[model samples]
Target: MEVIEVKDQDLASTLSNNSKVVIKYYADWCGSCRLFNPKYKRLAKDERFQDVTFLNINAEHNPEARSKAGVSNLPSFAIVENGEFKETIFTSKEEAVVELLNKLN
Candidate 1:
């Protein structure tokens, strides 16, 4: 599975159409963001997360996008499905991602 790099303008359209979307808010300079990168990619490749659409948005590059998504923290994950924001999972752990995926499924 490929991760989609999202911009502010495309947020609404992407969330509206995608059945399951996992939007990650991250900053380049953040150590936690860097650490979580591989886990995020692995989650995207996992069979259990196959139905989900992974979107990565650089918070520093797109502050407006981050603000609109209510991302007050770095390395945050928002689970959206069918245009609804299901859950906002925040943690640096890969297991947390797995838990969120299980909850969504």
Candidate 2:
């Protein structure tokens, strides 16, 4: 699936509309966040997570989305299932993101 860019206003609706979602919170100024972009995109196409909706929200600009996802660091990932927040992970490691995706199962 494609990674969609979500804004603060549309966040709630997006969460409610999708059954499984993995959101990547990032800031343009953060080097680690930039570096993880390709990996994230790759994961979005991953067969294991094909049912999941992939989203990108700029953490520095989208306060509502950031807070809703419980973001605590520069590069954080959140999983939402059934319109509810399931888990969050703050990491630059692709393995860590995969680990979080596993929780969705």
Candidate 3:
């Protein structure tokens, strides 16, 4: 599983470079994010999401980028494909993300 850490300055370019990008906006102090971290990492290791690039951005460190993505929640997941915003899934369930990846295929 590969996790890319994104910062504000390189975010746009990083998103543009990948045809499919799965970004998780999280903050260290958020309890929900802490709980979801392991599951999220497991999802990244799954073969189903191999083609999708996984990125983890610290929302607290990049508020501007978080606002740009409209992340009102602590643990937010966004799927961006072809530089276009696709869908967002906000939940602690790993199944939700697995289901979303299945649909993508």
Candidate 4:
């Protein structure tokens, strides 16, 4: 598993026809977002989530991606399964985010 940095320009294509993906919506200025960064990256490299695609989107720079994911807060997580938007969890807690990603696996 590899964590891909997503930009506004890549959002559409990234989400299109995606089988399984977990997107972390974050902004550089957010303290909580910064705190969750390391754990997010670690989870991306986790063996259990090998089949899942991990992505990171900077909300401030990628408004379209944030809006598309219905993310109203920083450090949110969105899951896309089988080309359909599944759920979005607005939380900065690494544990919560990891729990959600584990569900995908």
Best by TM-score: 2
**What's the count of clashing pairs in each model shown?**
0, 0, 0, 0
**Candidate 3 residue-wise lDDT, 18-66, digit = tens:** 8888888998899998898888888888897888888899988998678
| lDDT of candidate 4 over 41-60, digit per residue (tens) | 89888888888889998888
TM-score of 3: 0.89
Candidate 4 similarity to native, TM-score: 0.89
By TM-score, the candidates rank as 2, 1, 4, 3
Write down the TM-score of every candidate: 0.90, 0.96, 0.89, 0.89
Q: State the weakest 10-residue window (summed lDDT) of model 1.
A: 63-72
N/CA/C clash count, model 1? 0
Shift of residue 19 alpha carbon in model 2, Å = 0.4
> What is every candidate's alpha-carbon RMSD to the true fold?
1.4, 0.8, 1.5, 1.5
lDDT of 2 by residue, 46-85 (tens): 9999999999999989998898878989799999999889
Q: After TM-score superposition, what is the CA distance of residue 43 in candidate 4 from its true location, in Å? A: 0.1
- Per-residue lDDT value at 41 in model 4: 87
**Candidates sorted by lDDT, best first:** 2, 4, 1, 3
